[model samples]
Target: MSLISLLIALGAERHLSSPIWQFNFYYQHYLRLFNRISWINSSKSSASDNDGETATSSVIANTLFIAIPVVACYLIIEALDNSLLYLIVSTLVLIVCFGCIQTRNCYKQYLLAAFRGEPTTCELHHLQLLQDKNLMDMGFGQSLVWLNYRYFIAIMIFFVLFGAPGALAYRLLTKITEQNNTAVESDDIGSDLNKDVAADIQRSELPHAHNQAISVFSQKILFWLDWLPVRAVAFCYMLVGHFSKAMPVWLDDVFNIEKLPHVLLVDVAEASEDFMIEQGDCTAEPCLLVRLAKRTLLLCLAVIALLILTGVLS
Candidate 1:
């Protein structure tokens, strides 16, 4: 099921280059609706609570709201046979349906608006939201790992268990867990710091080293998970971005700690296009090479999964 889902997703990517309307009509719409429900529930819980309890209750309510759909999806997938076929067919159908729902004139208007560099309200809102968050200067390798984890690791595992629908369920679970943990940690620290200046002062002394340790720990985990996927994703990004950049910087950062690989790559790439240029520099050619590389990796993963699946079945 997992392999099937991956195959379908990969195929979809090749066929549907810009399925933004499909994504919006199905996935994005549902996510936004769920977020609204979570927000409202949290607000109601907060309103009912006293001063200190409000924060905790709000967090709990939001977490519950986020979890419901994930659990429901998982149960549904587990209860069904041939779930992989169902997932792949349903996903494709939904995408096609969404694409059909958009009039030809609407798509043309969207293209024209995109060409004019006119931002949608959603884009504007997203940009504004990013302004409030702290942007980490995670090295290119680290950034790639994060993306792969979010896009591939979690989804792949869940899909293998049930199918693509299960992948969606896993993503929701992962998102909710991550959000809740972050919120709780932030709240605890914020509350403690608010109460005790002396304690905060003492804790601040080793903040740099503490943060570095956490970064190293995270990078180590990412490196292990991203051992194969990093190369696959980097190639994809290179194809998408049309940059003839080698991931030497990313590889170096993953292998060694001292070098600021991300910054160096950007600097070198800007200075000279020849710096990272390989033979056969055409976009389609490079994309073909990347696709080939990704397919090879996927083949390796498939073999491993087959062994495991065989053992389980036996």
Candidate 2:
């Protein structure tokens, strides 16, 4: 069932871009409903309330807001058992969890713009596709690596661990973080960005405490959820990319809590490309990076296939 659902989702990506395949649309609905019930925005008007109490309340409220619906959906799916409806419902849930159709299309367009030697145009296209304008500084290739890790690899890891419910939960957690961060940034209207989002990517900067405006509790939870799966992704880069170079970076940063996930991913991806440029005209670097990411995805699928063959994945 995992393989079938993955194949169906990938097939939809390859051959279709219909509104029915828009995961963001469905995800937004879920987010809206969750936000309405979340205590994340609750005021601390009570004089007796302290910081610890407020933080704890926010965490519990956010957790329950997202958890109840996901648990209910998982129970319904489980109750279907071996019915044909099980496959259909599970497939649909998996598809929505996989990602939005429009996002992938926008990424493809960004690549096309990159290939045309239009750096400015590429940046514009990328800004349109990604929620953070600061991410554009990573270049198209590195940005692709970051998004692929977040929206694809990480989500799949949770799916394998806890099925469809896990997948939805991970994506929702990401959405909630982004939404909260965006809201915080908007409120601090006078906050200067330093115009170094791209420059910071180049440095592979540490994940600073000051930059976090989102709930620290939720961020910690996401970091724990991402820890193992991200290592798996880095290992995939080593296997399919430059093994010697990629391995050291992977080993060094695998335990480093300060390093951001996307920065680590982009570092390995940048090193993994087997570019064949003769005169250093590396116009194909962005596309090649994307290809390497796809290869890594295929490698992961192959391993899952092997596990299934050995009667281990079922």
Candidate 3:
């Protein structure tokens, strides 16, 4: 079921951009309903009554928000066990969680503009991609690589280990953190962002402190959650890319937890493939990194299929 769903989701992500596949419709609906609940409103009011939210409330709210959907998904899948409907519903969820059409479109447009020698238009699409995911801190190639890990690799690992609910949980947490990160500068986050967000929330200087604290709580959880998967991604880069060049960097940071996930990923990726080149070169750095990411994805899927065949995975 895992391998089947993976193949379906990946194929749909690549070939289909239809409105029916858009995840935002359901996502926004859930947000709207969740926000209108009486207790949710009361919780928010109390958290702001003191002009700040306690770490406890933020943790509870964030945990509940993710936990509710995850628990519900698990229940639904369990109830539909061993049926064709199970596969269909699970694949639909996975498809929605897998990729962003807008990001891909922006990248393609940027490349087109670059080839046409339109620097201004290239910059426009580049900014759109960065702003969409709060990835402005890195180079264009680096951002592309990071988004691949976020949208596909990380979600894939979680789904394989814990099924569709795991994927949904990771996606929801990512959405929270991504939105929080839009207003946060890289300098403000340093290497550790959780502490920084917590401090800012306590001071109540930042608008939306209640929401920011909730997001920061979720961010801390993501840091721990990303610990192993980020390293796994780096190991994949070593295999599918320049193994000799990527090995040391992977080994060095493989156990290091303080570095930002995207930073570590981009570092190994940048080393795995040489991105430095003269202007008007045939292959752009983003193109190379994106290709490396694709190879890594294929390699991962192959490994999963092999595991299923070997009776190591069910």
Candidate 4:
């Protein structure tokens, strides 16, 4: 299934402008509906002095929402290879039917507003009117909305159907090995040696040196994982924005032009910076790290979906 998702994602990447309008439309619709409902439920419960119960109910409702999508995804996976043509045709029809309604100018305006860093107070207020709590609850609702729509539901479906143990294993192994290596390196450099000797050892074992190694390993994994989907993201950005604007930023931020083939150092540096920024600005609306994480997540979901589809078809 993972392989199938990867292939589909890669194939999609080749034709970056392929209209996923339908898919995006339906997805956004469900997301908005789920979020609105969750917000209302949470607000009503919270206002009635049953905060705990409300929270619990909200969680359960969220769980149900999540479950439905996961089941739908699994069904899609089951139908993949057995009905390749049917799957393709169905997906296309879905895209077209949903896309027509979802591809409205108003939605594009909202997207542009997001990109341009405009406040979504109006949208938040509208959602709030449907409930009692304010925008903060709405924000939480949105997070819960994507938690199912984008991450757990999408990725789980792909991983379960495709057996993407390679990707999973690679991520796990690299993380574990990197942590062990860092501990060892830190221990080696922190011993009671003379200042000059310690400096020499530290030079040989720069703090970032271990990080660099881990970064390299991660990059390698992404290299394998990104064979198809990275381009898809790049293309999506291009279609929404302009090629020059989107591609250059993506190349510099995601591809790491300065580091190029060496993805680890760049990733580490970016990750570190992201952490610092998030910690510094706790109240900022969706910190840079969150945005990057979301993009990575979306990319992963797309890949996983493709893999599941491929596995079923094959």
Candidate 5:
């Protein structure tokens, strides 16, 4: 059932490439409502409490916000109590949860700009992407590689191991962090839908100080949540790419918690594939890295299918 869901979801993702299908449609509305309720309920305590108390309250509210949907998802799946129904619902959730449509579109535009020799446009797109993903400077190819892991591969890994609920939890956490990423254009990628969402969120928002607890907790918890899967995907990179080149870098950072997941993936992915990055040009390298990441994804799925075939997983 899991393997079947994976295949179906991937197929649907390619065909159903509309903004209406994106999870942000529901997330934006859910968050705005939650924010209002949380603010209203905590108005007095927040006014009376110290900074520590307010921060603690913020963390609690954020956790409850993330937990509500995840718990509901789990309960719904359990209540179904039938295999076909489980597969159908999980497949639907996976389709909605999967993909980085905005990022993917922006990447295509970036490539077109790069190919057209419009360095200025490429630079602007690059900066916006870095801002959206909250990443530091890395090669364009490396950025694509890491985003592939973050937006698609990581979610798939969690889905296989835990279920749709796990995938939804991870994605929900990301959306919250991405929401608080920047005050103005915090949209994960520049979707008009997301722009409107960000505008609404900011206008009704409290001060940055109020959201500090959520930002801190979400980043810290997201790191731990991503730790295992990041390594898991890195191993796949090693298997599908140059094992000899990637293995040492993988070991060096395997146990290092301080290294962010994207940084680790970028480093390992760079070693896994060979390419020459021109001084200012970001064209060919991104294609290579994206291809390497795709191969790793296929290898990851193959292993999952093998395990299921051997009755090691169900």
Candidate 6:
């Protein structure tokens, strides 16, 4: 069932240039609901607690928010008596959980700008995309590798391991983490504005302590979620790329599973950085990174197919 759903989702994605699930499909609705709840519950201001307390509370709140929907979906799928309907619903859920539509679109635009000799415009767009993925610290070339891991491989592995609920949980965690990172970046901007603006206009609507704690906890949870899958995908990279060059770093970083996926992937991916366009001086790193990632993805698909054929995964 996992293999079948995966094949269907990939097929659907190939035909649709835009992801069937919009970039903000989940986040937009979630934010609206969250704001509504906050408004109704404004009398309770416990969110402004101590750093540790706020962080713990925020983590629990966010985890419950994500897990509720995942459990509901799993229960709904299990309750279905019609096998055909079950397959269709499961396939659609996987499709929605998979793909980084906004990321891919921006990448295409970045490549177009680069090809047109607009380095300034390309770099701006690249930075914007990196910020959206909360990967600005990774730099452009390394961001490409990490994006593949976060948006594709990690989600794929979760689906294969624990089915739709796992995939949904992974996607929700990623979306919420990205949102928190954006908020954290805004807090930095707010600090600069606080220096320049009137005292009344300076203070942010969101409490600093509260927001900071949320960001800290969100980042930690995202790291834990990606730890296992990131290593699994890194191993896939070594298999498809120059193994000798990639393996030593992989071995070293395998112990530090708590580190951000970007740190580990960047070190290893840079080892396979031999691709270059001889005729043009345009950045070919993104292209090469994408090729390497796709090769790893193809190898993953082949493995899944073999497992299905042997009745190891049905």
Question: Model 6 lDDT vs. the true structure?
Answer: 0.70
Task: Tell me which of candidates 1 and 5 scores higher on TM-score.
Answer: 5
lDDT of 5 by residue, 1-314 (tens): 98999999987897876655677667776766775675645652563356657677667777788899999999999999888999999999999898867688789999999889998998788887777766678867778887787778888878988899999998988877776764433334346756666666665556566677678889899899889889989988988889999999999999998999888888888899977878877687888888998999888889888998899987
lDDT by candidate, in order shown = 0.40, 0.65, 0.77, 0.37, 0.80, 0.70
**Which residue runs of candidate 6 sit more than 4 Å off their true CA positions?**
17-20, 38-40, 49-53, 183-205, 276-282
In the predicted model 3, the residue pairs found to clash are none
Candidate order, lDDT descending: 5, 3, 6, 2, 1, 4
What are the TM-scores, per candidate, against the unseen true structure?
Answer: 0.43, 0.77, 0.87, 0.30, 0.90, 0.84
Deviating ranges (above 4 Å) for candidate 4: 1-5, 13-24, 32-49, 79-314
Give one digit per residue, the lDDT tens place, for model 6 in 147-252.
Answer: 7777667777778777788888888877776765453222212344333332322232346665566677777877887787777778888888889988898998
Q: Candidate 1 residues 1-314, lDDT tens each? A: 44444555645643563544233234333434554554554554454444545444444544565456556655655666785556655455323322111222233343354456564732343232222221144322222233333444435544555444555544444333332212122221234432353333232222233334433443444334434443444443433343445444444444444433233333322221232445433232223433443443464456547855786511
Question: What are the clashing pairs of model 2?
Answer: 137-198
Most accurate candidate by lDDT = 5
lDDT of 3 at 184: 33
The alpha-carbon lDDT assigned to residue 48 of candidate 3 equals: 66
How many pairs of residues collide in model 6?
Answer: 1
- Report the lDDT of model 2 for residue 157: 65
Q: After superposition, how far is residue 289 of candidate 4 from its true place, in Å?
A: 14
Error of 3 at 146 (Å): 0.8
- State, as a TM-score between 0 and 1, how close model 1 is to the true structure: 0.43
Q: Runs in model 3 with CA error above 4 Å? A: 52-55, 181-206, 280-283
Between the candidate structures 4 and 6, which one is better when assessed by lDDT?
6
- Residue-level lDDT for 29 in candidate 2: 45
